[model samples]
Target: MEYTLDMAVLAILIAFCVNIVLCPVFIPFLTKIKFGQNIREDGPNSHLKKAGTPTMGGIIIIISFIISSFFFLQDNFEAKLVVFSTLGFGLIGFLDDYIKVVQKRNLGLRAYQKIILQFAVSIAMIYFIVQYGDYEKMHIPFTDKMLDLGGLYIPFLLFIIIGTANAVNLTDGLDGLASGVTALVSTFFIFVSWAVGSGTLPVAGAATGSLLGFLLFNAHPAKVFMGDTGSLALGGFVVSMAIILKLPLFLPIIGLIYVVEVLSVIIQVGYFKATKGKRFFRMAPIHHHFELKGMEETRIVTLFYVITAILCLVGYLGTAGIF
Candidate 1:
């Protein structure tokens, strides 16, 4: 089926408008419900004032996307699958967030517990795609050739799901960071989804619309944080698209910022352990380092967005053979 540019634009506009209307209305409600973020003591001093900000605002985006999907995507199998996978991951994140909020602790679920749950959800998603989705071959970006993973596909799928989810989670340290980057990433996926001509393109389109909508309130001095709830769900949704469309390999290119953030944290921690407290940057995560280097928050975010847009364009051109 052909997807018109008009439909894509309309979906994005609708989702954006809905999010703008809902964030203000819902943020206060979230606070009243005691869904506040538990700020870590070790975080940047500037974030102390943001301690009581409402969290799990991702629920608003999730609900909006689900509703929008129903209204805009009818009988689209790929869209339905993407929605299901997103909700599944979101449910796990919601539980983790609930634990943090209820316990009034900065840490939520135990590491093993979170890993086990994420593994279960990812494995299930992989199985479903392998059994029900089209295209058994994985396409390498910028090339027409595809790789058939055969029995090894599950491991690769698991890696993509868990990696993307954690990458976004790690990137969520600052206000509006995760939401802004996610919106940009989703915008690219919308194009990829459409270009691939997979049945799930509408789902990607709907998700893109919803994320853009969420970003209106999710930008700087965020009234409500997307929390683990939104980041995990969005990450899962993106990975699901890659899996369904066999574009998992493209994540490192399109989501370069997230990749860099996750890598910085890993390198910093590892280096510190090896050197008995030697530091890698002013702070972990490349963005926070830039902040510490005296870059303005808006400028840093804009720069990251610009880089993401460029990488996204590369991914598109690579996939569409425009290079």
Candidate 2:
């Protein structure tokens, strides 16, 4: 309750430790349950080998976050809200992942189905945020002033919650990309939350620690993939931190990688439709375009990390004065 060291470093360590231990045990169990990933044949040929790697590893991050953040839970209401929202999205993702497992193939929930579920959660997130959120103003980048959105904040908040969740989901195509970038983004959120004296610090800590730990297996030649489950829930967690800090506007700058990932797909598809079957890139998500150009998976992932780190730094510096 006093913002002790355990609430900071120890919580991270605990989360990291938990994931490191649980992953090996969990991966085998998922395999036993036939919960393997199905690679898309139309995608990179190099990714075919990734097929059947145990999927749905998000449970590990969720469990690890809960265990580590539990220490500070009683004192932090906002942190509790984050945990709940994460679990809600996790369930939606789990259902999607489970459908893929049942079909023994890559195809899972239909796009409409997933969007409906996500929108349901987004609406709920907005209701809670509007009811209990601490501030009416958001810090505008490169300005010393905070912008007041008033009731308009509700619709804007809905876009952030739903859009960001799906954006991160699309970014999950590469191993270590989503989790690794999320770790960096969460690290920034943790600091930014502290800067604002937010009650959401514990959830931020959990996010940072669990994703770092998840990278132990989620890295190159990943032993396990977090699937839609981790990406969506993580997206929710990250944006929720912004809501609690009233920094939702800064999220696009901080979460620039997610923006790019989703945009690449939209651009690729929209162009193909307009051109009657031409591509703007060799593949969508941009990472795959790099992959098709012969860039190694690890290299592409690392590059993304660097870019995300730079954008996060920019977002931090820009918002520093207003906060």
Candidate 3:
């Protein structure tokens, strides 16, 4: 079955429509259920105003993707794999969000617990890919060379999934930061998936469309926060797509902002420990540093969006052999 651009556009439109229509209904329901966000006391003062916003709004995007995917994707192995993996990772995020919402605490899953769960889920996903698919060969973007990892593919796959999932989580410090960036990354993934002639492109396209729709409600002064639910799930979904397409290396290019966000935290922590509280930035995650430096939140987010868009174009060009 040949995938066409028209189908992709249609899928995106459906997802966008679904999300815009559903967000209003879901946001109010979440607030009614007392699932409001808990702001960190140490966070930027501007975030205090967002404290009571509805949380777990990722449920809206998840539901919209599932419904839209079912309607838009054709019956194919790759499509099924993408859909199932997305929901499976989303379930893990949902569990974490549930704990936070029920306990009314900012702390959800402990670090060790989250890591263990991520490992378990990532391993399962890799095993499924290896057993049911032919992805033993890895491809490097902008080149036709392939690296056959054979038995070592497991470890490599683990790194891609875990790294991407955490990078996105780290980038979620600011309002709409993760959602907007994720939508951009997913849009690139759709292009790459199509260029690679993969049957899963339609599903990726639909996911991108769904995210764009979600972003309308998820941007600054957001009516709802995606929390761990959206960030982790989106990270997992995009990473899995790259893995299935054998293009994991392109993630660093497509998700450059997320990488910067994660690296800022890592550097800050390392420096603080080495110097007994010395710091590289006013705050970690880089975004907060800009806020501390007196940059408006809206400006910082928009700048990041522009950077994300540029990187996404570079990724597509690299994948298309135009770079």
The global C-alpha lDDT for each of the candidates, from Candidate 1 onward, is 0.79, 0.85, 0.82
Consecutive 10-residue window with the lowest summed lDDT within model 2: 1-10
Among all candidates shown, the one with the greatest lDDT: 2
Residue-pair clash count for candidate 3: 0
Of candidate 3, the 10-residue stretch with the lowest lDDT total is 314-323
Q: Which stretches of candidate 3 lie over 4 Å from their true place?
A: 72-74, 321-323
lDDT by residue (213-259, candidate 3, tens digit) is 88888888788888788878788788888788877888788889988
Tell me, by TM-score, which candidate is best: 2
TM-score of model 3 vs. true structure: 0.95
TM-score of 2: 0.96
Q: lDDT ranking from best to worst?
A: 2, 3, 1
| Candidate 2 C-alpha lDDT tens digits along 1-323 | 45543466777888999999999899999999888888887899999998889999999999999898888788577888888788888888888888888775456788898889988888887777778766668878888888888878778887888888888888998989999999998888777777766767767887888999999899988999998888888888887777777787787788888999999999999999999999999999889999999999999999999999999899889876866
Summarize candidate 1's per-residue lDDT along 91-135 as a digit string, tens digits.
Answer: 888888988897765678889999999998888887777787775
Residue 316, model 2, lDDT = 86
